[model samples]
Target: MLNKDTLLRIGCFLREQTGKVAVYGLKLNAQAVYWHFPKSIACFLDRDINSGFFCGLPIRRIEDLPRNNIHAIVIAASLSAESHIYARICDFCDSHGIVIYSLYSGKLKAECLGKAFPAEENQESELRKAIASHDIVSFDIFDTLLMRKVLFPTDVFDIVEKRLREHGIDIPGFKNYRIQAERGDKRHKGLAGIYLTLAEMLGWTDSQAALVMREELAAERQVLVPRPGMGEILSYAHDIGKYVLLVSDMYLQPEFLQEVLAENQLTAYDELYVSDDRGTGKGEQLFELVRKEHPAETYLHIGDNAIMDGWSARVHGFDSWLVPSALQILKTTEAANILSFAENFNDRLLIGLFANRTFGNPFAVREKLVSVKSLPQFASFFLAPLAAQYVLWLLQRAKIHHFEGVLFAARDGWLFNRLYQAAAEIMKLPNVPPGMYFYGSRKLCISAALQEEKALEWLKGHLVGQTHHFLRECFGFLPGDGHIPPAWGEDTDLIWNEVVDKKESIFARSAVIKDGYERYVARLGLKREGRYAFADLCSQGTTQCALTHSVLPNLYGLFFARYMSGSSVTMGRVETFLPQADWHMLANNALEFIFSSPEPSAASVDENGNIIFEEEDRSDKELKLLDEAQEAIEKFCHEFFSLCESDGFISPAIGHFLLSMYQQPIFAGAGKVFDGMDINDNLMGVRVDCLLTNEK
Candidate 1:
């Protein structure tokens, strides 16, 4: 409310002024003056050459104003943002001897009426003083008290569009209509304003418009969340016994705004001031209503926008402050500083956008740390979000494609599977193709690969890369220490018989692996024809292929990523999901190394499902290192699963940085989390050749 102090300032300003002044900015503030104090604003000024007139006045550029008639230009706009022209207007005003006064030039509490300028950032404590002076503290609401989770303000519409799609409402190119609707809504002051436009353009009925509006509300309900500093400020206002009102220059009416407020647990305000409700917005005559509603009371306005929240509030004779977002700060400061070190344009964009969207606790950037580190802090920064996205994608695909529950493949799939289960439970997505684990691994599947004489021939041709440790560990052959294995011949059955006969092996690790596989099927209870998906870290499609040649022919493989073999079919399942070539971000080196188990994949599983290990004869140091890495991975995974919720998502931009973490040790430079962390190269390579690479 423009009370005694504010009115006294107006009286003092009038006494100082000799000639007429034009309010430069036809936004709600100018309209407010036009409605409340018409004689004060001689004319309206338009910085942009836009022809859209406001308040029945012919808008003029600073150049168009007559030098003799208009002696001053009251800048009822923002200098903090690019929306208004400050320098050009100042130059013209100065050159013409037309005195210019910026409304944002302030430190108003007791409200000393001044034309002198002041700075922006160092006013938070002073902002509290301004609030102290006010009987009622009226906030701008959107960026002031409440904040949306998305990047931009209008990203709210994108969520609405998604809701429309979900409801089977196909409105092609809805963005154009939305933009137009916004114009119409502001013009007519609500959703009812856009009804005619909708009917004229898309032949939408009043009922259809209502449905779209409801969907928009639903979208708001979906995305809306409280800002970070919400509690402290609101608590301060309440404790001070100040009448807090959420005054917004918004299209949504008080009733609708109430619904949103209640949903977000923000029902503390004394009243809601919406522009559309009165057909007048902030910077317009809307403050006149505020003045009328709460006579003799003072106000302090707070918001993110400089024009409406800061300048307009000051012009209307109230204290105001700008609350710059972290996004704005990053775009202004950190982006350029990172340019020298950034890998490329997209890399910079990823970093910038990630910093823009990702909001949480700051990185526990360790200082004066120990000499050695176990692993990188890529878990919180990269891997967690990546896994979350993967899980989200999996859920999305399962629902869209109508598949049975996913079966997580054992070994590398361990972490991913666990992540999926945890996220699913947290998000209440139990019905999203209910999942389970499948004890599938390269070691376990290699037995199925020995089906025919031709398969053994294929194996023989690809044995060059196999180590003595690999053979002894994976195949239950070559128990004695040897660099090279005994050369094999055409008889596949005879070769296996010699290998199996070397040790006191269970018959399950038999001559040809036929009886052993039969036992595996019975023990694991793997039905011959379940239409379930096999989840794993990566594959050459061989595990599924092996299963295809044996039992469970109807099963499919779901790998985190996969390389193509001659046949893309796994069991009878097609190659449905594969990362794009550009997604070869790590070049398959680091990620392959990281998503490993402490122990090599079990070369064999028995009738009772007990895992058979190959590293029994291995040294302790290698085992210890593997254990450390695995523990680190599990700890990272648990923390990730804990932090993720339904409200947040893993964007492709976040994924880009995540891939960068693997592509190169990008975050390693931070040195706090990963200064001396080492990759266990020993475990990076599986003992046996899973792919049996085509050694040319």
Candidate 2:
């Protein structure tokens, strides 16, 4: 419950202290330790042999712990587990009369150490006073006023490589060429000049280089966006009657910059300056020019780089604030370990930077600690962004593809449709296009399409040496209607009638199935010749194909994931992290667990298409957990819609990243998300055989 001010005070206290400071948790993989401590750290306090502290730095054990001269010891373990560990450390520190800094107990985000940037959330009064004291303020354009949606500045070269491939020139090492070959020298000029040098160096044709340059330029337009609260800063300066100038040491030209600014509607600056036009950098020459032009005024520069903004401005007699880069902030946190997979610091920086640009670091908890305890709040924090993306994509896809409507196929699609409706309301699109939760499952669709000879053949095709019991269930036989003995291997090749030996019974059953299916469609009140898309979580095109081939011919599939008939040829390139059918049934698990399914899988319908209830009261434990999860999910959708109504839309890149975290291993990871969650059958409480491994 400690506020950032308290944490900042502790950080300042630690920073002011002099001497050989030691970090207690760095050797124990305590992340974000450096972010809250001084640069004078001299040793680590861990005795574990397996700890990654092999830098030849001074290391300590509990028995040999220094009681003197070691300025301060900072606790960097997680907030949840650190208190217990700190109690022992605290007693030792108190006895030794040594200063102790508990980073886990205080807010690390509030500390302005390392690459941690203080956003407009803090230091507002100081910024305002500094602006008021000065007649002019210069802001670094990139990473200050505008943020690029990438980790490293060089990562943009990946887009250029993509462009090269599209133009029939696939360079294997183009990213490296852009990162390594095209910088820190006068060899290349202009924005595409580097690509030109890269192309020539790699013996690529001028056409290929031109294509790369074209793509790089286009990528800039797509990538650059206003950082959160940037416009407010600009407006605050303008309102105070302070002259604002945009400055950068970038290769992109002023004209292109102006175009990009205008494209984003960020033309509030009094002037713009770039190193490309000046042929010199932002150290002194740029300031000299600005000072001469705007005489008799104090200049206050706010830029991301300490050297480029701070040292340069102070040396030139102008006031400056070293606004850390958002990318750098991400880099620090990624180092601190919010991103579990970020092993290398540089790689963490890249991902952190990308995530910042994409979703403004969705997991950036200012005060709240991230743990299973905060999972109930995940709706607004994690899932709302993802849900918003799906809603927008559905809308755009429906419009562009000229589909009449999308039927959110039952089970997962049912929950998706409800959320979509909430999103539509939030977006103020009351006249939402044709979209509805079409109550249809694979079982329902297949059964409705049965009675035809083709369906009979399709059913036969599905039973490839499988049990006759499976075949019976596949045809929606009511438990023990037909006597089909189980078989294995080549024995399954027996004739269908011979296996069942109930032709009269099957004909009567076929009539009931056909009638039920016809009634189901009739009850839906649909018109003919409607181009409908079957929407599902991870469709195998079973429901889509069955409905299209047997019932309706104008059905297309819009699914999160799609499996082929036998091969891995997807219906389209599905952008998802769905566990494969050969490994785990992700869609099946989602249908039963993630989505708000109040009942079991759809059983056979009555002749009138009324859903026949296979009544089984759910266990109190499963119902409580499922309802809690579903309620949280629904609340998250509500919050997402509210944000949309207020013109706040989540990005798809961020959404995709969060969804990736829900992969099978991650979802069921012990002590992580969904640690105790189980995969269960809604009807019979039967654990899906494979998932039973994680049940305990």
User: Can you give the TM-score per candidate against the true fold?
Assistant: 0.62, 0.48
Query: What does candidate 2 score on TM?
Result: 0.48
Flag regions of model 2 displaced more than 4 Å. 1-126, 203-208, 332-354, 357-381, 384-409, 414-439, 442-511, 514-696
In model 1, state the lDDT of residue 559. Answer: 61
lDDT tens string, model 1, 1-696? 233443444445545678777777777655655666566667778757545567876677666776538877665554453224444565566667776655443212213321112334324455566667777777777755665544455555655555576579878667567877676533354766765566667888888888887776665565455555553566577678888877788766689788877877777778888887876666555655776788754666666666677665665565665665535443343233443444432233334333433321111112211122333333334444455556656766666656666767655666666667766775555567777666556546656556445554444333333423334545546433333443322233434545444433422343345446656665655566656666666565656666666556666665666655444432345443435332233324334444554555555655554656554433466446445554554544443333233333334445534445332222333323332223322221333321112210
Question: CA lDDT of 370 in candidate 1?
Answer: 13
Clashes of 2: 0
Clashes of 1: 6
**Candidate 1: segments with Cα more than 4 A from true spot:** 1-136, 152-169, 185-187, 192-206, 240-243, 287-299, 326-357, 360-381, 388-406, 414-435, 447-466, 479-533, 538-558, 562-603, 608-654, 657-696
> Which number leads on lDDT?
2
For residues 1-696, what per-residue lDDT tens digits would candidate 2 score against the true structure? 333554565567666777756766653333344444435566677535423353445566654546546746766554444535555665666667566655433322112211212444335556677778877888888877777655556656665665565568778877776766556446566666666667667787887667667788887786677776666777889877888888788888899999998887788888888886875566436766777778854677887776666544544556677655665554444222345543332233334333453234222323322233333433333444445456666765565567767788766675678776776766565445577877666666666665555556665565355435444654434334444444434344455655355444555675686577667766776544677766677656666765765455677666654454562342323323233354344324533455646665565678887865445445676566656656676664554343231222323445445544333232223224344555543322234531244431
